[model samples]
Target: MYYFNPDMLMMNGSKMSFEEKISVLREQLASADAVVIGAGSGLSTAAGYTYSGDRFRKYFADFEAKYGFKDMYSGGFYPYETMEEFWGYWCRYIWINRYAPVPSDLYGRLLELVKDKDYFVLTTNVDHCFQRSGFDKMRLFYTQGDYGLFQSCSPGGASKGRTYDNEEMIRKMVLSEGYRIGDHGELIVPESAEISMRVPSDLVPVCPDDGNLMTTNLRCDETFVEDEGWHQAAERYQDFLRRHKRLRVLYLELGVGMNTPVIIKFPFWKKTEQNPNAFYACVNLGEAGCSREIADRSVCIDQGIGEVIGALGV
Candidate 1:
């Protein structure tokens, strides 16, 4: 049911400066009955979880040297010839993004802004940043799946309607690649020897129940599993929306982009339009905006999320 409609996109060329918009956002957050945070990859990027550049180079240098992909995102989709090689790239990818510590406290600062309020998170990001930073698990909906989980490749099995946690296996695979775990759980490249670009054949993950190949729990295709937890979270999100629909609600969007607007962007716009009491605020680096129909009730701050959240001083 989630579908993007380009015609629904709109922006206002407001005369209000960034300072004025920040002031308005602060006022709205304080007064709104509920806050529904719609997050995306950009928020993670803002929180120092960049998918490219030095961060990618630091962890994925072995894979980069072998595959020639400059960024982590590109490496994720590379068609490796063997499962050992595939898992070699992905285990590190999942570990650093999901299990390792983030470079900054941006998520914590964001939580400070809404810790006491009735807030629910709906994010496209697979990284476990929000929960890792102390956000309540029951109050979040990860629409794009998670990096810390794996799903069964078989259509019918005990793994049906289930997702397996990958942390233990990811660690095993990383260690198999000759990487060492740092004191703080970060992956450390061994100083004395080169890291392997492939995992041991036995390290490739398989479904426990059916012995089938396991895939990343990300939502790239129809095969993505929607387990009981995913369903419960979806229902909770709907309940939250119903309870706040006509009240003073703030659709606080952070770092969302146009890749899959229907999941968060379009719905936020639609809901804002439907409820006169609703206010929509977007804080993306460049894609911040709302429908012109609801322009008067919206604020689009095309600024970095970390800067805006920091300025809020919450």
Candidate 2:
């Protein structure tokens, strides 16, 4: 099943045809003894979970009209004057990306590609798309914190370093439908209600150990929760790499961008270079290119993740 074709490899030279690229990629994936999937924000974006354009407009039209921002990323960093407004935007962001289902079966198609093979995922996406698509939970290590988990981010609350799944509480908040825009465009909520831009102070989630406000468990700080579950997943990823160090493994990187090249892109290149029996494949639209060092053993498909995954027809 080994299909390591040095001649078919293309570096920064004339690009390989998309069909040829898919063929080589299919062979590598089919023959690999183990597969390590490295995913990033782009992968989720490719799966129709983009944080901008129609998606953002649909979810945050009020915010956009008030703030003059066009996308969710800009809105996430917007200096909202109050925690209520912040949660107004953040909660919806989390709910749509985390709790709600994606528009496409990209993750399902991906699961079918590697379901029977020995595969593990190392992804920076927090959307929980992999698990939602039926991938085994034990085989995943979400390097970044999950959108569904929350922790206290206040200075004093840092010591109360407990993080827990906030899905239930968030569901309650969302289900309450406790918010609306006022005549002046100010976010309005019932004063006594526990969930809204201006709900009662007691209603919002806070640190159980202290009264610090709760925030998503994303990797923005040193205090981001690496709970017992996170550690177990990390150990499993390391073990998977160790067990297949020099075997016929494939490092399948998907839609990884430059935001964190060292995490996924650089490591995949290094691993492929170090292991002659290993093959490396990167699928990114427009941003697909391999370093000259491992170019011979790598396949760079400059096509959208969903398109290529669809082409595989698994």
Candidate 3:
């Protein structure tokens, strides 16, 4: 129901030097009554979880050779011939993105910046990076489904209405493909000849209830399951916003692009516009900006999130 009027957006912080914006953000963080972070793919990308380039080549070269897809994102959408092939690609995808050690301490640094404040994170990322990096789970809400969970795809399966953890199965799937687990839980590719693009038929995950295939818990379609946990997190987020409606709140948006503006971008704009005591800030490499209506109360820094966070000296 949210509408995005491009004409209302502006990179008004363009007038301020990067250093000035950083200073303002730091001061606001220290003084604001609460902070609500809206994170997207860019934040994880800043933390070295890129979907393409070296990371993609390192983990997905075999996939690229087998299929013509160049990046992880595209590979997700590829119509594989069988469930085995699909799960093979997805298991590897989940292992690297969800279980592997974070490449950088960006999330930890971000946690430090807000750990002392009353803050809640609203992220589109499914990597479980925030929890893995030690952010309070109670204060975090993963609006999109997780990479580490799977839900029954069958119409009437016993587990149809729930999500199940995929860690154990994903690890097994990756290990089956000759990828070894390092001391720190990183995936190590085995010899070239041992790599595989399909898991064994028996290794493909299935719903225990009716023996049907289980799909990722991601919100790709209406079939996406929002279990009890999801509902609770949504409730908590609503409560947080309600409590801070009239407070000196800071909407700290990080690396959120235009992919799903209604979830984070537009809501942040609308909330900031409603509260005179609220401040809105965005940290994105290329798409940093704010609604022109709230330009005076916003700061949109067009810089890498890591660089901006580093400059904050927090």
Candidate 4:
């Protein structure tokens, strides 16, 4: 049984009725001078971008049967027999997660809620949903690497690789075998039994910087690319905080997880604790709550983010 820690409830609204909590949150949204949205995979999950179960089966049933890896996350780490097989798995992974249209308009709704407000987004999620949802690109910082980006997998001067948008590269590799991307984000392999085998060596994407293999620009190690764009976004986030120090700022965290608590949750908590004008709210399904130190001004809702944000009726 999942315990609903009342202490985790934000804004001291543990005892408040559902509608009452929504009212309080709504009022805060309406009155705040600025909002800082912290997001994680759970936000995308709430937006119907799941990585496991049916979604995985739909895209990777053959891999599951062959490799016994059940979900997309597990498959990423699986040791495949050849680069041919590896790129086969990864291109589809990138196309679906990076290029597929979101099923739910949760991000779009959240954008509507804060479109007019002075806002900044700090997110651990790599899905590029903020830009897709029509949020101001200038105000958003994706702390994690994007799926649509590729970096040199080498270690050296070219090691600190610059990021490249790999949309065209991914499309080319996936189609090299005559596999068409399906309408619902799965791969449609050729009628000929061996679709992935025709994947040519030239189809293997390489780093222009170093002539080495290319890998997704995700944060897997110290080599994760932090090019100019990343630093610029980081600077902007810091500037936003400094500029909004005295305003009624709301640090609204949505679906953030424990994978890297310091990135979003811990920093937000510290900021809220230090700034009297800052208010913190965390809306995660079954994971909503704040530390006791910042409890008075926090609003932690133990509910699905889509449900909570939808209730805001933005």
Candidates ranked, most accurate by TM-score first? 1, 3, 4, 2
Per-residue alpha-carbon lDDT of model 2 for 1-314, expressed as tens digits? Answer: 12223234753576577888899989998899999999988889878888788888766777888889998889888888877677767877777788776768888999999998999999999999899889999999998889998887763444354677887776655545565434532334566855433333444777776667788888876768777788999999999999999899999999888888888888888898899999988888877766777778888787789899989985
| Alpha-carbon lDDT, every model | 0.87, 0.80, 0.87, 0.82
Q: Which residues of candidate 3, in runs, are more than 4 Å off? A: 1-14, 155-157, 191-193
> Mind giving the per-residue lDDT tens digits that candidate 1 earns over 217-277?
9888888999889999999999999998899999999999989998999999899999999
Cα distance off (Å), candidate 4, residue 35: 0.1
> Who is ahead in lDDT, 1 or 2?
1
What residue pairs are clashing in model 3? Answer: none
- Give the distance in Å from residue 78's predicted Cα in candidate 4 to where it truly belongs: 0.8
Residue-pair clashes per prediction, in order, are 0, 0, 0, 6
Those runs of model 1 whose alpha carbons end farther than 4 Å from true positions after fitting are 1-14
| Higher-lDDT candidate of 2 and 3 | 3
Model 3, residue 285: displacement in angstroms? 1.0
